[model samples]
Target: MYSSRNMCLKWLLLLLIAVAGGAVAAASSAVRRDGGVTYDRRSLIIAGRRKLLFSGSIHYPRSTPDMWTSLIAKAKEGGLNTIDTYVFWNVHEPQPGQYDFSGRADIVRFIKEIQAQGLYTILRIGPFIQAEWTYGGLPFWLREVPGIVFRTDNEPYKFYMQNFTTKIVDLMKSEKLFASQGGPIVLSQIENEYQNVEKAFNEAGARYVLWAAKMAVGLNTGVPWVMCKQDDAPDPVINACNGRSCAETFVGPNSPNKPAIWTENWTHLYDLYGNATRIYKPEYIAYQVALFIAKLNGSFINYYMYHGGTNFGRTTSAFTLTSYYDPAPLDEYGLINEPLWGHLRELHAAVQNCSDTLLYGQQTNYSLGPLQRAYVYSGDERKCAAFLVNADRNNTDIKFQNRTYRLPAESISILPDCNIVSFNTAKVAAKCTERIRVPTMKFDSPMLWQEWREVIPVFDSTTLRSNLLLEQMNTTKDTSDYLWYTAEYEVPADAKAEIKIGSRGHVLRAYINGRLVGSAHGYFRNFSFTLDTTVLFHRGVNTISLLSIMVGMPDSGAYLESRAAGLVNVNVLGNQGSKNLTDKYPWGYQVGLVGERVQIYSMNGSSKVPWSKYTISPNQLTWYKAIFDAPGGSDPVAINLNSMRKGQVWINGQGIGRYWISFPKPDGMPSQTWLHIPRSFLKPRGNMLVLFEEEMGNPLGISIGTVYLKKLCNRYNSYPFLGFSSTRRS
Candidate 1:
């Protein structure tokens, strides 16, 4: 009995020692909390030990709050220690004076979810983020404000920016959501990629940046403030890089000292021109991350899209109405791109293992070629990590240091322990299924016609009102796609009166008796052109309807600023289209569609729409309605609008997307064509299809179909995920 008691006491003492040691280590590992800032480091020198930190980005409005916890949980599983997000100004303050923080737009809830996952947060309050968002996330009302030049040192612009930024800062303070106040947000970003186009503004551009830095620093968020793409970032404002190869985009000219940060490591390029079908190789992306870490020093990395979510509702902006393509890994439907998710997870785990060496150590570079290079982050001579890169567009095998490495086209390689090959840039073996829309039925159903009439007198109203005559980009806003350019005309009988109309190059359907005479659109040309005079009268009250439709908005540099996206000049022509008609007439105008006032898609909807049954009719330019039960399951659904002309489609009052069937032949110019129906835009019951058809076509020919990714058979390598092996197939 004495011997047993003695043994038990010894065991108890050992357990107590272990517990105390762990407590000390944990206390030391407590993140370096200096003021409102936390260094994203690998270890805390409590007594002297190493730890790991993980992070991710969760744009609150990208997904609903209901999805926040699950999304953060997924990030945790993927070994993320932080959650980063850009606070969208448009989504938060949708209207002037009305601030919304509820629902999916709840920034606080989103950070709390990240905190719950034991993760830190990076709040990028760009207030001016250009994430392919509409108007670059600015309130539409700003456009209507007089003399407001955005991103410049104009009074109106600064006044609005200050008010909005202050509101956001105050809100965060109230919620104690900043790391400085024990909130999860450790870092806050001010102006977005301003330097990308700053050269256009000259001195004002430099001045605007200085003012932005001062403004952000003055907020006193108790955390570090960063500005991505700004090389001339002022003191105390850390400048970060953003791009596909951001690991190389240097900190702007006059700035140094602050830690280098890869603010947006674009895992996959976002979709453009409405294709949304391009799938990037997962192995390639993993290699990119590994290579970024190896090449980029100072140890801060953030994936632009850790999980690319759906662009629900009207949030999906387009260069044209039909440009809905995003080549992101997670796709718009929230589907986990298998090999991408898996391969990246492995890469993250590998990075975590070398966190200590990468975070605190200095990296030295060794050259191979412009594309191929090496980065060694060393603590001790033998204890080091190496990264080999081959960003070559073509495949090449390099024998380096007595080890053979096969480099695929556009890839990077990571060597954690110098001798062992852990990850390669080219070896992703997953076969990307190029999804095609297959016709389920052998023959398309019979057709029904519809006759529609244009409200011709729409352009002849006395009160010609535009949201603002000449509003600036991201300012005057997107309240009305149509701008009323009212001018009257006097038709001379012998003068051969003709109306030559020119617009910003969009759909312009003209009318005489309010009867549709002819239409001109910019889709076929950079700008639209038309001439008509058939409905001439003896100089009486003549009305003309010029429906100007906004195909999409402009997104680019300063020259695009003055390029004019709507109607530029209109003239009255006579004498066989070569002569001029009455030079002057007071024209009236209206903006947007006639149906916008009825809240056609709103739930508290006033109009009772009958969508369930189908009817046959000969209608030109008419609104067609159809209702069908949603096909069960989570697979994506697409409406084959091959038979339909140009129109806007709504599923359950939610815009499934726009459809334009006119495929421009190989004219050597891009055109608006094709349509995609995302499953996220579907509804189980009362699934409505509202189409504002521009031409006469059979709506009955339209049918909803499923788009499935077909398995691809590779004939090259015998790899399963990438290439297929056929040697053993009998």
Candidate 2:
């Protein structure tokens, strides 16, 4: 929820004209021209005083660079003076000593875009930011680092984390991006929501937080540093609260020396792939904000995701949806026609009208009735601001200042001058879009289907052979998601045997002697599963190949880095006898899917390999290619992956991440069937679409069309795929 910055927002004109957020303060001890940002017991010191600071999160990597300028502009228009973003370390330093800041990972460019918009910036530099990101935003290669233990007081972990954090701070200093350096950045945050997982690490976690605080403050950013979701964030490092409603629960800072700032007020809540979409009510959000500022004496407020963007590529954690559009005020496509957008814009403006009073006034409270209360901020020159609240489940009459008013249930009313009600949290002019009637899309007929060739991996020298079963992450170092475990074994007689595989997996697919067996996938709670599929084996040398797929890495919990993934154990059990495959290193391992090699997903690369007649065979590694013209409008494009099983997509050689349609949908609203493609990602004609299906899937139902905004990267750059040897029978 945000309103116009500089307070030019004048909505709800019938009630009263809202006051504008003043320009940057001249200069004082609190803030200096040469660049110094300080804070007192009340609020963050910006431009020499505690000004009205309204912020919202818009993670840069979550969206496109082409979309950044437009997204930030919308935040500005919606009354946001500040834009906060987390510097995802995984996006920056993807490898040890190897860093990338190009294209969408260009964070400096993103920050400059915010500066260009004339708004403040809050840089949340978390090497371990767990925003449902892949490996909690830690680079996949961190698990490969020797003597590494994540998030604790481990020396190796701290070394990498601090190194990256300093690199970012130095980068900001070099670019003059901090407010103290005459840049837009006013605050810097280190370590996000550590308290949530702190208890798991025990005293070591406690020590790590202190060290993180000291280390961050030592960076000398000239701005005060903060740690959200840390209760014991140490001296000098301001600890802020993060939750749905900070106004009702957040009392103040842990110490009297700090301001009561809300680092995260979630405007939307996201779920894993199978779960339904959920969000908060706009009116309730407003009421919470009113209570926050009026009752809790709240200072700064930030919406976690003012513009919830997509989890493009393979950036999400295990089982998380590719669509990270959390139903925030701004939809995933940056479309802002939703009622929550307009409603909150007005709400922010109304609260901002009383900013001056709250910042300088002495607070006073009184009981109007049962569960009814009033907070009066009496400031200088008899000027005042007041908030009337009814906390009961049912609306009740409250008398304040000799006037009787009916306060809406669980709502707050704001009076900028302690008189006329300029804004009431319960009374919104907009209608809820839930009850509206509208089809999800204006779909063009399914694109004309064409016959395409397919490729099935032939286990041979192209894959790595080992005498023993290798741990997944260590063997591949997370170079790719798919891994193959193939072994040739003797079977005494023609019989059925259970191929038991204990896989620390998101998915496991098996193939016996070039024939399909079956596949099993893990849910959100458990990514590890044991597969006991029975298959017939002729009395001879039979090849057993098991493919282990990781949806994403473990993001939270203690010692996540040390946790084992992939197929940990393999065996064959039958009435005749039981044979163990893992004990003697009896398998050959392939790091990634054969299609991933030779760039089979690419338009030009697909031609190198001969493709045969199409088959929608289940439990087979397959690739499908097609082309289509770009949709006409700027509306976001949608490609329905309903009929398809689990797989990945690529457009014009760009990987759009993986998809799994087999996961049954609970809510039944299209069931996350469509993968949204940005309009900018498409060309007018001949847009190459490629799919690497892992199982039985029909491309006939696969359609690329346009959907309105209403419903809503890459490793391996340095090293090319080794050698490619193909086995094709025509």
Q: Pick the candidate with the highest TM-score.
A: 2
After superposition on all C-alphas, the RMSD of every candidate to the true structure, in Å, is: 12.8, 12.2
Per-residue CA lDDT of model 1 for 45-66, tens digit only, reads 2113333434455577766565
The lDDT, on a scale of 0 to 1, for candidate 1 is 0.59
**Tens digits of per-residue lDDT for model 2 on 1-730?**
2336312321222112111101111121244545578777778777666866779999988888999999999998888889998888888887788889898889889999999999999999977888888888889777778999898899999998999998999989999999878898988899888888777876667667767876776677778888988866665677888888677556468767577888888887765766665666676677777778877678788988898787877787888877675477777767774566767788778878878888989999988876788999998999899999887767788888888888877778889999889888877665434211222332223343333433333446445777777778778776678777888878778999898888787788888887778888777877778888899998988877777888776677677787777887888889889888887655777788656767876777877777654444432466777777887756667787877878788888876767877776575543366676776677889887888877777776677766554222112223211110221010
Candidate 1 vs. true structure, TM-score: 0.77
